[model samples]
Target: MCSGFPALFFAVAYNNPRDSWSQVVPIRLRLLRERFVVFFGKGSYGRDTLINTLGVLFAAVIPVAVLPILSRLYSPAEFGLFGVFAALVGLGTIASTGRYEAAILLPEEDDAAVSIACAAFLFLTAFVSALAIIFTLAYFIGVGSVRAHSALIGLGVIAVAFSGCVQILLSAAIRKRVFAKVSFARFCAALVSAFLSILLGASTQYAEGLAIGVTAGYAVCALILSRVVARQYGGVSLPDRAAIYGQVKRYRNFPLFSLPSDFSNTLATNLPVLFFSTFFGSAATGYLTMFQRIWAGTSIMVTGLGETFRQRAATERQQTGNFNRTMRVTLLPLVLLSVVLCATLVLLGPKLFEVVAGVEWREAGVYGQILAPFVCLQFVASPVSWSFYIAERLKLLAVWQLALLVSFSLSLFVGSKLFSAQGTLAVLSCVGVVLYAIYILISERISREENKVS
Candidate 1:
């Protein structure tokens, strides 16, 4: 009788198009469709995002597609080790550039931007050398992980060098608006990395092989981007010392403020893997890494959007002295998309992992389900967080980053002491949701402030 009632209601609603439900539902659906079209339509902010997203989509697809095979070929412990290695490389890359690469998109003059790029490279070379020395010292002192994985750590230093160069060059490319070239470089890097990882996995079941593959990928990406940027910027001659010094002095806030902010943020993001590896076990770390890898694959679209948004927001801010409208409009679509994706992960992530990767990965899927809310909020917040840079709110951003780091550290410590690993992740996810919500509110407020000032 209940089923019949629903069917009869639908029939009556359809038969009488003037009915409230019929009229309102179709109008709402039509409005949604129109918004979707406009969001991705020609000559819109979304057009640029779509282009970058497609590139990221192509790049992400290869690694994601190969994950099942890699899972079969490598043990969870090896993947956990690889995750740690990658995290170290990430931290190193950020330090190597001193975050001066981020300033490349700020200056109006190409010559000024080039000077910043040159400064970043100088920092990279010095930092990489220091990193090599530090790792060698750690190994000699019998730091267990360094001594055990000296070869992998050495490869990580090389990866750090390449990744730092790629970061600087990629920023130059973004400044030049050559996104297609950037996309192509990313695709090639992903292809090479996937191939090498598989080949190395089949030959030797060591985490070093994963590190090698990634380093090679970065090498390839750096090579391609270097050439593209060189050509776009009319050959890569060194800028004069005065020019470099002047630009460095002008954008000194980047290294002074953005560097630590970025470092803290990166540390907070990677703290869990380190925490799990330290206290829980490599197997637990591997499970967390697997979930992170899967989540990263799904979030690449947001990454693309964020990248394009940064470039666009910078330009709009420069021209109009504010980007409040663009930021607000972009938020709605991102929020909607994140909700849909996170809901799916919560509902089906475990089963999906079991079917696609193996039964061993089912736990990773559980992590995905638990972290869905956090991931969703992060996805929505991250794209807009660049507003801090656009609005030159470095001090405020730095403060937020410090707070995030402290909160995350406390949550992880307390959760680990009190609960199981899965429960720890649940606690961490709840904390993340709250923090990321705060981040969104802060960013929105910043945008509003800029609008008022403008």
Candidate 2:
């Protein structure tokens, strides 16, 4: 809101009113226009939506672009190993951090932040699970059937979990209205990780390289993000005594409610690789990761749209209860676009694969094409789950996601065990269909709730 900088200096430098006025007047208006644009840019959801979409685009591209190059150098089995390990790391990481409720609740003041306190305690409980894993590995290594690098895998888990903590902290800081260092710290982490991945002796095998790259990347990210967080909020603080006991006792519903919901979400998003590894081996996981990338790439586009809808809905919902319309308004056009894109991929995927990655990844492209519809469905479905969370109706959504996962996993496991990779994916797509159905039901319920409240 500051203006007249030029006028102030000019008036001080020249004692004449006309001289100062004439010289500084245009500059003042010019400054005003620039400030207006800056304000418009920041205030508009569309501007940020575009920017976030592009960020997701580049990130999604990074793995796929690297996939071809890495596949050229390594085998399917190598990438598969990387895929499986990545999934396992992700599973452990989600369990270890366990602060998502805090990410949501810290923005609102709870009586004693007991929801947050209990969430933190649950995270420590997750670490106890990690401790169990460590001991089991130690015991197994001594018994001598598996001659693997248990410590390296353990490092990956710790690094990813720590990184998740930092990432969540960064999110909470932003929710608290801290913005200055978040972007720069995030960029620095990514840049450092990319450079470190190209190091000469960091890894020997393909899976090893991915594990090392991810761990190193996350470590760097955590360091940078932590610095930003500390600069903003004076670093993370533990819950006080009353907060510990009272929050735990009062907000115990979160564990009973949000915890399982969160875990089901975690499992639905990740369990395919974990289960696939159990039966079809690592090579199948490698193919699945490529599909994950392509599907994820499409989902990134969906994100930009969803963000726009969510912000608008947040504003609109207070005045009107037609929040479901917000999603439908944006979702329909995108779904049509998805249809064309999916068809193109289904027809041309193998050709694209052969050209970009050679024969080794041809199978991956085929998998990608088959899963395109499911990917599209999931992307739209994701924002619907938020409606439940926003309405404090997360338990139903969580139960549905868990039920879907169990059914899907059972079918996929049976198929992969009896048939092949294609069978597993096909069954997975069927599960995705069921998830889509759940999304509709949840969205409908949210709409009904809004209508009743209104």
Candidate 3:
């Protein structure tokens, strides 16, 4: 029968009331269905979050589903190279827009928002051009990794540009409340990247193929989201020079404070891969990369929820001048999710890796077990920490990010000297737990103080 058959049957039974069983069962089922519909209906936070989460789920699953095949097709050292290349691209992408994209949702005026987007694009162009120049010089001088893998220089530049564009366009989409489009864009990117990676791996079996797939995926995502933003915003236009400069000045704090904060945070997060590659060797870096990929798969839901939370919290702050209630509601579910994730990883991490990605990846699973608590806490803290942005506490946020960088670097250094790769990860995880806990506490306090002021 059709998809609506069960609903129709229940409705008819409820109306007819042939017996007590039919009457009570239909009524309860109908009520449950109605509740479900309402809870995820249009314009509801639940609906937006569900859309984003499902999108992220599909995106995350694609790469994860190919891991078994990819593991067999490529060597650990090749994966390690891909991991480092990704880290560099990530760092560049974070700086590309000069943090202007983060302010896209903060402005009240559509014109102002458009101007900020235009400014972000301008920054992105300059940043990418400079990156290309640097990469060219590095290739000529045979400096660092770029000299060894000249192809990566071009791939890095392309990935950074596309990734930066995706970030800017995504902010515009979020502001316009076109969550489904955002979700679709993400899924498309992931699908394209995963498919290309597998296809290229089978034929080329080169690390460059992996990076090529990722860059192509970002290009696709950027193209899709650019169209979505164009339709939603009635085509993005560059404001007059005066208008663009005005918006830039108005949101100067974003570049000044948010840029550094974001850069530091990204650097801290990606430093371990570089460290592993440098000190522990490529195989170790590969294992760590695998663990991070698995962690990323689990955390995509949190990332999606956080996107919705940021938009909702921003709206609430604009209306009520505080988002304490929204923050609290978001926090509880995240904590519960964290608990479940931690328990699962601690118990089944290595075994799960062995079964899914082959015996060679068991080491990565051990890394997962060691880092589970830290990542779980991170899953909780990252969303709540948006309070720093909401409350205009950019300076404080920058300080905290710097502290995280220092602490993380120190932990990695000390742990590496004193212990094995697993030991170093353990130490890093411990430091992360403490820092993330402090972050959550401070975010709560910020929300409370904003409430009191409001």
lDDT of 2: 0.63
Tens digits of per-residue lDDT, candidate 2, 1-454, equal 4346855655645776556667566667777888767744664545555655565556555655555565566567776776776776666665564544454444356333333534564665577467657657766768452346565466565666666666455565455443434545555555555455445223455466666766776777667766665565443465666656565555556556666666667776777877777788778887777667556655666665666666766656666865767657765776677677778778998777777777878888888777766776676576555565555565566677778778767877787778777877887877787778667666755754663321
RMSD of 1: 8.6
Best by TM-score: 3
lDDT of 1 by residue, 1-454 (tens): 4454356556657788578575656666776778888976665567656776788899998888899999888888999999899888888888899899999999898989999999999999999999889988898888997887789889999999999999999999988877778899999999999999999999998888788989999999999998999899885567899999998899898888778888999999999998888878888888889888877887777777787778877777777878877788889999999989898999999998898879998988998999899989998997888898788787788888899899999999998999988999999999999999999988887776643322
Listed in order, each prediction's TM-score against the native is: 0.84, 0.80, 0.85
* Candidate 3 lDDT over residue span 1-454, tens digit each: 4335566565666777577466656667888889888978788778878887888788889998888999877778888989999999999999999999999999898889999999999999999999889878878887876767888768989999999999999999999888899989988999899889999999988889899999999999999998998898885566898988998999998888778888999999999998999889988999899889877877777776677778888878878878877889999999988999999999999999899888988888899999999999998987777788778787788889999999999999998899999999999999999999999989877876643322
Ranking by TM-score: 3, 1, 2
TM-score (C-alpha) between model 1 and the true structure: 0.84
lDDT of each: 0.87, 0.63, 0.87
- How does candidate 2 fare on TM-score? 0.80
Backbone clashes in candidate 1 total 0
TM-score, structure 3 vs. true = 0.85
Candidates by lDDT, descending order? 3, 1, 2
| All candidates: CA RMSD (Å) | 8.6, 7.4, 5.8
